[model samples]
Target: MKWTYTIQTEGLTVEQLLRDEWRLSKKQVHELRMAKGILDADETPIRWNEPLAAGTPVVIQLADTVSPHVPEPNPDVSIVFEDDHLLIACKPKGMPTHPNDPGQSGTLLNGVLGYVHAHGGTYAEHVHRLDQGTSGLVLFAKHPVVKNALDRMLEDRQITREYLAEVEGNIQKNGGTITAPIGRDRHHPTRRHISPSGQPAITHYSVTARRKGTTELRLTLDTGRTHQIRVHLASIGHPITGDELYGGAADSAGTYKLHAFRMTFIHPFTGKKLTAQN
Candidate 1:
């Protein structure tokens, strides 16, 4: 795969672009250098250590890698946003983001692979995941370099993910932040709870609506942990409706009400601000 990028700042070296700006791994940099993958607009080889002027176009080339997931085409899957480097798809509630075992079909990743393969592409990977019971937008990387950049972005909290959920009780406070450590629940195989020794987790929420039996909430995460939103809300005595694992009431459809309604992030390759809503 080949992509072109123009230098936005003056006097930027190839080393700085790879190491500091794109944050490419040492192995990735070595591979590119070995392949002579970075070239000028005229297809001439560019020196890695030399500085280049602003508006200079650079072409990047990388070998295409095969996708690991099995492609079982399903038209039900929806692709919301897509570019040469990334894709964002809507995931329905009750579907796993990826398969737990090899050769598994019907998971979101498999469906995505079908779409990618059909479109003459060979690679697709999810950058982040939502629980099987949560419905929302899931971001996917079309290539390995973009995947690494996105992973770093996620660790730095540069990507924003917002969720809407209905909880079991009315929250008296209009808005609040949950700053608690989250650890695994020993008794349950797939549950998390607050613990002093656990990793730091933060959730921000505001009450959107309050009815007689439940409250609707808009939540954003500063730290992404396993079941962070559910655990934090339940810790505050307002577990999400239908999140039975967290001690909340069940819903008519027997699934959680949490939805990842919005996501915003700067495009790793194009440097464009991208937002997707469900």
Candidate 2:
């Protein structure tokens, strides 16, 4: 894979661009250096420690490797946003974000791999994931550097993800935050619950609308624990409608009413604020 960027800041060294700006891993930087991947516009290798002036074009080339996901194209997979560095795709409900095992087909990642291949690209990877019962926009990285950067951004809470859900009961408060720890439920496999000895989880929610027996909510998270939103809402006695596992009423479709409605973050390379909505 090869990408080119024009130096925007004066006197920026390749080392700074890779380590400070892009946040590439030390191993990745060393590999790039060993491969002579950093080059000038003329395709000649450049000194990593040498400072380059503004407007200087730099090219990066890396060994091409195809994604491991088995491509199974599905029309349901929708690409909402795409660039050389990143992609935002809408994941349909009832599909796992990625395969649980190698060579698994029919997953969202497989479909994304199919899309990438169709576009003549050799690499694609999901940065985060959505629950199988929920539908939402998922972010993907087109390269390793951006993937590492996005992973760090998510860990630092620099990326904002907003969710919408219909719960079983009306909430009196206009807005509130849930600050509970979440851990695995010992009684049930694949279930999470609030526990005193668990990882800290925080969710902020506001009432959006009230129906006859359900309430719509807009929620944001400060931490992404497994089933954090579901566990938090259930703990407050407002289990999400159609969330049968959480003691809420069942849906006709047999899936929960949760949706990742929006995501906002700064582009790793372009430094532009970008938003994607489902």
Candidate 3:
């Protein structure tokens, strides 16, 4: 199976990719390079000196014969918030929250791994996820109790996530709800699009800013779904800027303009109203 992952550390280079960031020693990085374990997204071989900023998406091939293919590695991340129990970092556009494929690494998960290992930290589980193109505050649970509690909170809608986005065309509504259902785009299993036969998903949005040729909206979710904001906005004829998957073309800035911006939830342990904003 083909799997894709995104880099989540800022100014990360190829050398750092195989060694330092991945917790691989210099010798180990050399070994992977020799074994053809890495490749750029375009399947080109990138030298160990190549530099990829945080949020770059990297694809690793694991099943095919290991010959010679160095996939893409792009790492970019700017933290907006953090705590002992969680990290609400501001993810750049084009970075996946985790790796869904088998037998490989290099993701937000990998970056977290490097961070933890370097500092003698703990493993954190993402209570939620963001699409490769969406940028926002991600809820990461550091400890076990925090993870379980946040998971429960998410299931119960105790967390309020607010995102900022500039979508195609002008949005007329101050606020509205998207109650469409989503499922695997059977035509493209690796991709997701809205389908009537899909599960019910509800998204709420309020117009935050608008101008000619674009509308900026504040998005909040009552339910989480794959491509929730992107699909929902596109379904309403306002695809996120630079998101060609739904409607807009890829942008030169190379980062999705969306920002998680805000989230409100109760502390998993303290029961205090927890809010993080960027």
Query: What would the TM-score be for candidate 2 when compared with the true structure?
Result: 0.97
Highest TM-score model number: 1
Per-candidate alpha-carbon RMSD to the true structure? 0.9, 1.2, 16.8
Model 3, span 1-278: residue lDDT tens: 23344666787776665444334445545655776656678876666577787676665443322211112233455555676557776666666777677534555655654554454454656788877767667877655434555776787788999888988788777889988997888787666788988878999888988788988888888888877888888887888888876778787886556777898986643346878887
Provide TM-scores for the models. Answer: 0.98, 0.97, 0.68
Candidate 1, residues 160-236: lDDT per residue as tens digits?
Answer: 99999999977999999999999988898999899998999999999999999999999999999999999999999
Q: Clashing residue pairs, candidate 1?
A: none
Candidate 3 at 257: error in angstroms? 3.2
Specify the poorest-scoring 10-residue window by lDDT in model 2: 64-73
Among all windows of 10 consecutive residues in model 1, the one with the lowest summed lDDT is: 68-77
Flag regions of model 1 displaced more than 4 Å: none
Better of 1 and 3 by lDDT: 1
